[model samples]
Target: MQLTQFTDLGLRVVMYLAAAAPDSSPSTKRVAEQLQLSYAHTTKVVARLSELGVVTTRRGRGGGLTITELGRGASVGWLTRQLEGDGEVVACEGDKPCPLREGCSLRGALRRAQESFYAALDSVTVADLTRAPTRTVLLDLTRPAV
Candidate 1:
């Protein structure tokens, strides 16, 4: 199953923040520019993250965004599940019934596979994604502009 761009950006935002210097908080605009995401989209994602208690946002001068310790420890699988919800992977839900709905095991199979996907992701945390080479790369991206 493929992750939506929203989920992708959410993960990137957390990783960027995790890699940032301990005392530095990055602005939403900076996060957007560094990630090449639209400012509005970044704003929405950051807002959601803030609401979820994964990140904190401060307003006005000397204010910016920072990932919480919870954010750093957040499981990728849990985040994906929250972001993706229980949306069907197939077109099985509607007023009209699918022809194979009665006897097909496709939906069940897909569900199991999706569970496996999430289980794998569950083993990984935002901090896990920022190790070594990835940490270096994310740090570069989050670096304050000269």
Candidate 2:
């Protein structure tokens, strides 16, 4: 199953914060610019993350975004599940049911595959995505432009 852009951005934001220095709190604008994402979209994503208690935001001068402990420890699977919600993977359950609904195993197979996907993700945390090489790259990319 494909992840939505929202979820993708959220994961990127978390990884970026994870790679940053402990005391360095970056602003959403900086993150947007660094990641080449739209400022408005980043703002909305950050707001949702803040509301979810994954990231905390501070206002005014010297203020920025920081990942919470929960965020740091968040499993990729859990995050995806939360972000994706219970949305169906296929159109099998829509108003117009598939003709094969009664005897088809495709839905069940897809569901199992999705669960496997998440299960694999569960083994990795957000921090796990920021290993030395990746962390170094993210740090360089996230450095504010002069």
lDDT per residue, candidate 2, 1-146, as tens digits? 79989889888888998887889889999999888898998998899889888899999999999999999999999988887778767888668989998999998899899999999999899889988878889989767668
What does candidate 1's lDDT look like per residue over 1-146, in tens digits? 88888888888888899999989988999999998998998998898889888899999899999999999999999988887778877878698779999899999999999999999999999899999989889988977889
Candidate maximizing TM-score = 1
RMSD to the true structure for each prediction, in A, is 1.3, 1.6
Each prediction's TM-score versus the true structure: 0.94, 0.90
Scored by lDDT, model 1 comes in at 0.89
Candidate 2 has a TM-score of 0.90
lDDT (CA) per prediction: 0.89, 0.88
